[model samples]
Target chain A: MHTLALIFPYAVAFTVPLLAASLGGLFSERSGVVNIGLEGLMVSGSFTCAVVASRMETVLGPGNPGALWMGLGAAVVVGALFSLLHAFASISLKANQVISGTAINMIAGSLTVFLARTMTGSGNVRIVLGFIPSDIPVLSGIPILGPLFFTKTYATTWLMAAVLAVAWFVIYKTPFGLRLRACGEHPQTADAAGINVYRMRYIAVVLSGALAGLAGGIILVTYSGEFNGNVAGLGFLALAALIFGQWKPLGILGATAFFGFAATIANVSQVIPQFSRIPGLLLKAFPYVVTLIALVLFSKSSQAPRASGEPFDQGKR
Target chain B: MSRFKNLFTALAAVVLGLLAGAVFMALSGSNPLAGFYYLFRGGLMNMERIGNTLASATTLVFTGLAVAFSFKTGLFNIGASGQMLMGGLTATAIGLSVQMPRMILLPLIVLAAAAAGALWAAIPGFLKAKFNVHEVVATIMMNWIAYWTVYYTIPAYFKGTFLETESRRIPALASFRVEWLTNIFRGSYINMGVFLALTAVIVIAIILEKTTLGFELKAVGFNRYAAEYAGIHVPKNIVLSMSISGILAGLAGATYYLGYAVNMQIGVVPSAGIDGIAVALLGANSPWGVLASSLFFGILHSGKGFMNAMTKVPPEIGDTIIAIIIYFAATGVLFTRLWERITRKWNKEA
Candidate 1:
């Protein structure tokens, strides 16, 4: 019961960011553009949100919801703008998607560090507008699970879940979603059918940027309560979750939960006597190892979108 | 005309990236010219700095070759970081334990590091070849595992004291110090490692340009189905390419430890391996091109401290510059193709 209590909060916390990134990924991959720069986009978003929130506190005082929303908006804008680099390279210039994605990652990683060092006068920045839990009278009264899962859940978690539902509807039950999937599976066929493959890819990549940005914002505002160099690698882990989930919306949510559970175990194990001797680094690395095993086991049978990484050339195709 | 247009496009992309970087510097209230001055002067002002840059570049050359080698076989080996880490740890272990003569100890330790790197990379390679897994995903996941394993193993098994997390100092017998060349380089860190890196480049170049293995790898990359029909074992070539690439990356780690970081333990988290990707990309994954690119990155990296001292700009500016260079390099091919198309359309209209 004690372990379960400790595990639940982290699982909920992990879901917020995971769903955002996976949805962002879904948007891109569904439209025939593979967004590998999801990690970088998240980093840029997280940093921007943290810095803006911090600055806003100094100007507007501590408890400003307006400032927080503005910070979130800033993150979305920055993420989308930076994603244009990937869009230009992969969609317009027809470069290797992986290389372009990795380039974005490098740019995001370095730029954030550089900006943080300059603006904060230090390598790390603390989050200021901390999200306090709002309790509904009846829901907050429930026993252990209430506080663990719902009562303490941040606004972002609820928002992400809502977004996931909308994403599912958009992806499977809408005309836009059909066109996006058509673009991914066969851009040439989609082009012949009058869908603008390039335009769809651009929109998908930009939307991916925004969601990844929101994931970054949620991490800084809700989970870490700070921004630092540490979050750079988490984006990559999210990428792992996307692949492990086999590119499905709900599947990615489950994969993220699993990873989150692993993280919580590593964190909670510190208090338990039986697992105290295990090095924290090894435990921290558990999700990555699991991801490796999952990829090896599932990749043989897993199928990616047909035109996933390939740039669509109208003339050639 | 199209070739000329393509060249101009590539040049323009590089210029635009640098211009954007310069704007960033201006926004940060630093003089771009001053920063460039410090970058160049600090890198080449003294023999010692030059040697340091050369030494750093030597390792990057091998790692770049590693990345480029796998790329030729149509694989993206993001596991270079993990492979390099494993190699460094293995080399350090051998360097401390071996008591043989210098000639024997040097080769033995180097070989051990290479073998360890190859073994580390082989896991992803084997998985990819056997299961048809995407190398990018597998290699990246392996990188994280390698990072954790090295982080834990070093501290648990090799720490000298509670405060220090590094292993014991490596024995002098196993060290690959070239005292005479050090004098010629004006007491810089340059040593036999540079020669070894050059040799590796030459050997790789020969294999890629002149050997059957190279042809097999290229054929697999060109089209796996066709290669299979042509009697080439695509899976075997993929595995072999990654293994060889891993070995090269391992050699880089060993050389760095043996030549410059002697007696010092590597940091709990590694940086050199990650930086190699930037070098490899900037070099366009060409052997000779890698040599120049690695040296350029090395100079930029080593000169950062000097730049900070001379100018108020932080050392991280160097990283920003390298990141910009990589971004441009990654998209250079794309910009070139775009330029070619535009020019051809314009010419036809004319």
Candidate 2:
């Protein structure tokens, strides 16, 4: 129980960013677009958030939360704008989605660093402050669950949870969500039904970009506290989580949590004496190896959107 | 006419990329003309600099061939970085451990690297062939697996005396840098890898153009179902194409770690693998085209540092230019449409 409490906060910290990004992926893939540029999107967001927050800190003074909020807002906006490139190439220009996504990654990676070098000679931006963790007043009074879920938690965790809930409701319950899924499953049928397939996919892809940007912002304010031009491949991990979760909202949550826990255990094993018996290498490589096995297991029953990677052509039968 | 069109498209993409880079430079308050002046001059000003550019091109040539070869069979081999790492690791292990004559040892190292890379890539090929999995995702998974594997293997068995991040340097005897070649290039890192890359270019060209296997592979790439119906073994060819691609990438790793760099470093997924995609696209996925495109990229890469030192432009501008070119290449269809519209306008005017 003691150790569980000790690691729970860290686990949640890891899970929130992944959950946010995976949910973003869910929106894009469900809209009939395969977005392999999630990693690049996250990098752009992180870079935007870092630059905005660091600049705001000098004016607002250190420890002000307002700067972080402003940074998060900027990240979301930039992320949405950046994704338009992918949308244009894949949607309008009819380019290969995977290749376009790869180009997106390369552009984000190089351009951000290039700009950073011009702004700050070092090409790295570190903020003066991040969100401080505090126990929830009312929730902390609970017995077992409080310590695991509420105590010593960053406010961003609850914010992400709320976002997850809203995503679930919007995707599963709304008429718009049905149109989006229909576009992915059978765009021709959806077009005949007057669903405006292109518009739905555009909206979905943009929303995903915004959410992924928010995920990057959350990483900046919560745990990462810096932007180093790359997100350590967390975006790719989120893509894996989306696949592992079978593209459902709740499934994404479960899969991200699993990866988050595994990552936390690997990270903290060196500090804890009980975990010292396991080889550090094994612990470090555990999640990736498990993801591979999961891929093999799930490949046969994949729930991927049928028309996800295909460009819609009205002239085709 | 189609070949000429491909050449024109590639040239246009390069022009667009450079213009985008200039826009970035102007935004950064640097003189784009001056930056480019220094950039080209840096790559060609002296014998040593030219040698460095060629040395850089050697690695790009092999990786470019790797990507182009796989594209011939309709597979996107994004795992070239992982394959390169495995190959480099194999060569590094042998270089560090073995005591042998240079003639015999170099061949052994090259062969070992090739085999290691081939095995690494074959797993993804197998998965794609057997499980009906998408090669893109599978290759990505393989890349991370290889990353973690290297992250583990390097520090555990091959750690340097002072730094845990890198391995011990290869001895001169095991290195691809020979005395006469070093003297000819005025003590630059130019090595026998250039010859190996040239030889690979010729060999791959022959395999792709002159052999029945090449015909089968291209047929499979054109249309898998049609090729299968025509009695070609699509699955076998897919694996074979990937394996051959892996062999090229592995040889690239050998050239890089054994020839250019002295030691292996952990935690970096080589950018050369991703850059190979750009090379292949620019080269039109042809062997000779790959060689030409790689040399251009080589100049951009090797000149970047010198350009940074000489001007206000940041070194990352070179990488940004490469990336923009890739984005433009991915949208090559847009250019084709624009070209048709312009041609129609010209005809109307005439």
Candidate 3:
């Protein structure tokens, strides 16, 4: 019981970013645009959040919680703006989606490092804004569930859960969801039925960028408290989770939980007596190895949107 | 002329990429002209610089070929980094443990690297062929496996005297830098790897252009269904192409770790692996084209340090500039489409 209580918070914390990023992937892939740029988008978002939060901390005073929120907002906006480059290259110019995504990664990787060097004299941007965990009074009073759910919980955890719920509802229960999925499965048919395939794809990609950016902000405030030029392949891990999830919202939650738990185990291995003796590199490599195995097992039945990587052309019969 | 349209499109992308970098430099309060001036001069000003550029380009040439060869067979070999690592590790292990004369040892090292790389790539290839797993995901996963493998193995088996993250330096006798080549290049690290790379180029060119096997691979690339209908073994060809691609990448690893750098560094897949993608794109997926474009990229890379020292532009800025160029260069399809659109509009107007 105590072990569960100890491990749950950190797992949830790790899961949030993967959840956000995978959800972002869902939005784009379901709208017929394959977005391998999620990692780059997250980098842009993380850098933006760190830069904004750091500056905001200096000006608005660290006492204000609004500074973190503002930083998150700026990250989302910048992420969306940066994604326009990918959108334009992949959609408007009809470049290979994979190549365009790779370009975004290269640009983001170098641009952020460049900016960090110029502005901060280093590749890292440390932030003053850190989230504090608070106990919800009534929930904290419960028996086993109390500590697991309420005590010493960051507000962002609840926010992420809420966002997850909202995302699921929007994707599964809404008319827009129907149209977005239609665009992915059959863009030509959707086009004939008066759905604007290109517009839907653009919106989906932009939303992906926004959410990925927000994930970056969440990661900075919750986990690292600093922004380096790289996100340490967390974006790619989210992508692995997306594949493991089979492109479904609830499945994504399950997959991210599994990965997050694996990641948590790696992070807390030193504290756990049983896991402490293992070499750290093997532990570090544990999640990725699991991802590969999971992919090999789960990817066979993955029902990816049919037209996901294709360029929409109305004249193509 | 029509067959050369891809070349023109790639050139246009290069020019536009350079222009965009210039704009970025101006916005960053640096002289773009001065930056480029030093960049070129740095790559070519002296024999030492020229040797270094060739040494650098040798890895790119092999990696670029690896990418281009796979591209010909309609596969994206993003696992070149992993393959390179495996190859390098194989050579490094053999170089360290085995005591042999230079004649037998070096050839043995290159062959071992190729075999290791081929085996490493064949796993993903086999998976892709059998399970229909996307190569990108599989290859990326292989990269991390290779990364962690190197990370663990290097420290455990061949830890350096001071650095925990790197292997011990290779003995001079086992290295590719022959005394004659060193003399010719005036103490530059120009090595036998360059000759090996050139031989690979000619051999691959022959294999791709003059062989029935190449014909079959090309058919598979054009359309797997059509090729299957024509009695070609699609899965076998896929595995074969990827293995050959991996062989090139492995040779690159041997050259890079055994020749250019004396020791193996842990926790990094070489940048040349990913850059190979852009190289293949800009080179129009041709063998000779890869060699040429790799040399050009080598110039940019070798010149970056000098450019940083001479100009106000920071090294990070130079890196950003290269990234921008890679971005543009890799999106050659965009330029092709733009060209098509322009031509259509011109025809309509005329």
Instruction: Per model, state how many residue pairs clash.
Output: 0, 0, 0
Q: Residue A5 in candidate 2 has what lDDT?
A: 89
Summarize candidate 3's per-residue lDDT along B1-350 as a digit string, tens digits. Answer: 44466777778877877777677667667898997898889888988888888998899899999989988988888889999999999999998889999889999999999998898888888878877777777888788888888988999998998999999999997899888888877887678899999998898898899999998998988898999999999999999999999999999999999999999999786988888887888888888988888888888778888987897665665556656766776566767677788878988999
Tens digits of per-residue lDDT, candidate 1, A170-213, equal: 88899999999999999999999999999999999999999999
Question: In candidate 2, what are the lDDT values of residues A1-317, reduced to their tens digit?
Answer: 89888999999999998998899989999989888888889889889999999899999977578998899899889988898888888888878888888888899899999988899988888899988999999888799988999899988898888999998988889998888888888889988898887788888878888888888888988898988888888888898899889889999999999999999998999888888789877887788778777878888999988899888776664
Question: Which model scores highest in TM-score?
Answer: 2
lDDT of each: 0.80, 0.89, 0.85
DockQ of each: 0.60, 0.75, 0.61
Order of models, best TM-score first: 2, 3, 1
Which lDDT tens digits does candidate 1 get at residues B143-251? Answer: 7777767666666766655346666666656666687878777888786889899999899889988999999998887788999999999889989999999999888
Model 3 DockQ class? medium
lDDT, residue B300, model 3:
79
- Candidate 1 iRMSD in angstroms: 1.9
User: Which candidate number has the best lDDT?
Assistant: 2
Q: Model 3 chain B — which ten-residue stretch has the worst lDDT?
A: B313-322
Chain B TM-score of candidate 1 stands at 0.90
Error of 2 at B173 (Å): 1.8
Which portions of model 3 miss their true places by more than 4 Å? Answer: A279-281, B337-350
